[model samples]
Target: MLKEQFKQLAIGVAAFTFSCATAKAATTITVAVTPTAANAIVDLVADFVNANPTYDVAVVGSSDSLSKDAIVAGGATGPYDLLLAQSYSVPANLKYYYPTLVSGDPFPFAKDTLVLYSTTVDISQGIPLQLQAFSLPDPATADPYGVAAVQALGPEYLYAQGQSLTIKTADAGGSYAQVAYLGTAYGFTGKSQICTAVTNVDQYEPGSFHHEYVLGQDYTTDIVLAGVKIARTRTVDQETALTAFVNFLVSAKATALQHHCYKLPSAQ
Candidate 1:
C-alpha cells in the first residue's frame, strides 16, 4: 500500500512539472503599428495566431511619430516587441535606437501614395474653388504622407492656383476620419486610406466620396511602409517568438494581406 501511494505521488509531480514546462514555452508578442495600417495589422495578427497556436499576439496602433518615439525612448520594452512605421521616417527616427531597441534594418513591406479626398468635390471639373479648407497629416511630426501632400501642392502642381488654402494637420487615421465623417471638404492622406474609406464607407460615414491621385505629378517624395523588430528585452523564448512574428509579416501571405489595404513595394 505504501508503494502504491509513492507511485501515485510521483506521477502527480511529473504531471505538474510537465504543465509548468508547457506554460513557459508559450509566448506573447506585442506589435506597435501606425494608425494607417491598424486594420490590416489586426487581420495579419489573426492569421499569425492561427498558424502559431502556441504564441499569442497583440497590436497597438498609434501615429507614426509617436510609435517611433516610444520605441526609441525604451517605452516599448514592456509594451511592444515590434514596430511598423513609414519607411521614410524609420531611418531618421530609429537611427539612435540602433541594436538596443531596434534589432536591425527595417523591412519594407508595402508602399502608399498621397491623394486628395473630398465628399463634396466634382473631380470632373478639376480643382474646385469651394475646396477652401484641407485636412492634412503633420509633416513636421514625421508623417511621410503629409510631406507628400504638401509637395503635391507646390507651384508645379495644378492646384497651386492663387486661391489660399487652409491646412489642418492631423495623423493618418485622423486625416481620413476628417474627410470621411467630420465633414471636411478636402483631406490629404495616403491612397491606402482612400481604399479603406471606399471599402468601408457604410461602416464609416455611409456617404459618397471622391479620391484623386495628386502626387503622381511629383514623384520626388514616396511613401514606403516598413516593419522593424524590437530588441530582445524579454526572455530568450519570447525573443524567438517575436522574431518569428516579424518574419511572418514579410512573408508572401502577409504581403498579400497588406496589399488589400496598401500598395505593395513591388507594385510601385
Candidate 2:
C-alpha cells in the first residue's frame, strides 16, 4: 500500500510540473511600428494584451526617425521583439538581425498609397489650376509611397520641372500649416504626410486646393478594410505566436483591422 501511495504521489508531482511548464511557455512579443498604420494594429494588440495579459506593445513612430535606423543601429539592443518596416524600408544594413523562417513569408499587415495633392486653392473647376505644377517627395530614402509617387509623376517631367514648390523639411509635429506654407518639400510619405501638409495649408490657405494620386503600397491591411490609404505593419519571429496573432486579427470577435478603416490580408 505504501508503494502504491508513493507511485501516485510521484505521478501527481510530474503532472503538476508539466502543467506549470506549459503555462510558462506562453510569451508576448514587442513590435516596433511606424505611425501611419500603428493605429490599426494597436487595436489588435490591445485585444491580445487583454486576452493574454502577458503581451505588451511599444509604438515607435509614424515616419522617418525612430524607424529603420533605430532597428538597424540598435540591432538586438532595440526594444522590439519584432520589427515592422516598410517593404522598401527594410534596411539591408541590418540583415544580420533577421532570422529566416523555414516556410512562411513575412506577414504583410497594411498598405498606404501616396497621393499627389495641392491645396484646395490650387484646384479650380475640380482640376489643378497650376497646370502640371507640383512638388514631389524624394524616392531614394523617404517613404516608399513617396518614392513611387515621384515615379508615377514620370521621370522626364520630374527632371524637367526645375523643382519649385519644394516644402521645407520639419520634424513630425511641425504642424501642417507650416509645411504647406513652405510651398515645397521633396520627401514625403502617403496620406499621413499629405494630411499633415493639408492641415498646415488649411491653417493658412483655409480651403486650400489639394489633389492626390495613389503612389504605392504604404501598409498592408487585412482584407476587410483594405481600401484605406495607410495601414500599420508588424512581424513576429515565432511561427506560433505569429499565426496566433494573425488568427486573432481575422477572428470575428477581434476584427480590429476592419474596424479601423483598413482591410485584413486575404486568407491564403
Candidate 3:
C-alpha cells in the first residue's frame, strides 16, 4: 500500500510540472525589415528575444502580400501585434485602409537612409554609353529604387540628346538581388559582383563597374523590410502568429538589431 501511494504521488507531481511548463503565455512578434533594416535590425531582434522570455520573433521579407495580410487579419485571428515599415506607405497603404481591418493606430518604428551601392563598371573611365546608360525600372510602375535613381539622375540630363537609360522592370525583391542583376547584366561578372563587389583598377581591368550614389528620392524602399508594408497573413492563425512575433521585435530584447548593423531610425 505504501509503495502504491508513493508511485501515485510521483505521477501527480510530474503531471503538475508538465502543466505548469505548458501553461505559460507565449507571445510572438514578426518584423518585415527592408534589406537595410535586415542588416541593421536583425541583431536587435535577437537581443529582444533574449530579454523577453514570453515572446518570440519572426522576420519576413517585404512584398505587397505581407502588408495586405497584416492589415486584413484581426488581432485574434490573422493578427500581427506590431509592424515596422518605411514611412511613405503608412497613410496610403496601411492607415487609409485600417477601418476595413483592425481599428487602431499603427505603431511607428524607425526611419532609414536610402543608400545606393554597386559592383563593377566605372563611369569616370569613360562616359556611360549614354547619359542614362544604365538600365533601371520605373518607380511609379513598380521599382521604387529605380524611381529614386531616375530622380537622382535629373530628368533634364536623362532626356538630353534624344538618349535614355534602361530601368528594367520586374516584381520587387531584395536590394542586393537588384544590385546583382545590375552587375551581371552589365557584364561585370567576377570579383565585381555589384553589391558585394567594388571596382579596383589595380585589382581588375581599368574599366570595372562600381556603384554610384544612392539617390534619396526612394526612401520608401526601406519600407519593404520593415514589416510595416508587407507580411504573411494568408490565414487568421498565420496573422495572429505573425503579430505575436512582431511584438517581440520592438520589445526590450530588440536591442540586438543595433549590434547587427541596423541603425535605429531615430539615429537619422
lDDT of each: 0.60, 0.38, 0.38
Which residues of candidate 3, in runs, are more than 4 Å off? Answer: 1-25, 32-36, 39-41, 73-76, 90-92, 100-108, 123-137, 141-144, 156-164, 169-175, 181-263
Q: What's the residue-level lDDT of 83 in candidate 2?
A: 47
Model 1, position 71: C-alpha lDDT score: 68
What RMSD, rounded to one decimal, does every model reach? 14.2, 17.1, 15.4
Best of the candidates, TM-score: 1
Q: How many backbone clashes can be found in candidate 2?
A: 47
Backbone clash tally for model 3?
51
Let me know the TM-score candidate 2 reaches against the reference structure.
Answer: 0.53
Q: How many residue pairs clash in each candidate?
A: 0, 47, 51
TM-score of 3: 0.54
Better of 1 and 2 by TM-score: 1
At residue 136, give the lDDT of candidate 1.
77
Candidate 1 stretches greater than 4 Å from native: 1-26, 75-77, 124-126, 156-164, 196-207, 214-216, 266-268
lDDT tens digits, residues 121-187, model 3?
4453322543434444345554445445545456533473246344343322233334443342331
lDDT digits (tens) for residues 1-268 of candidate 2:
2112122221212111001011233343445554444544555676665675544433343343455454445544444444444443343223324432112334555444443444434432322334343444334455454345445545444553565444322221122223354443222324433332212231212444444443233222211111101112234423355456555654654555444323335532
Model 2: how far is 123 from its true place, Å? Answer: 4.0
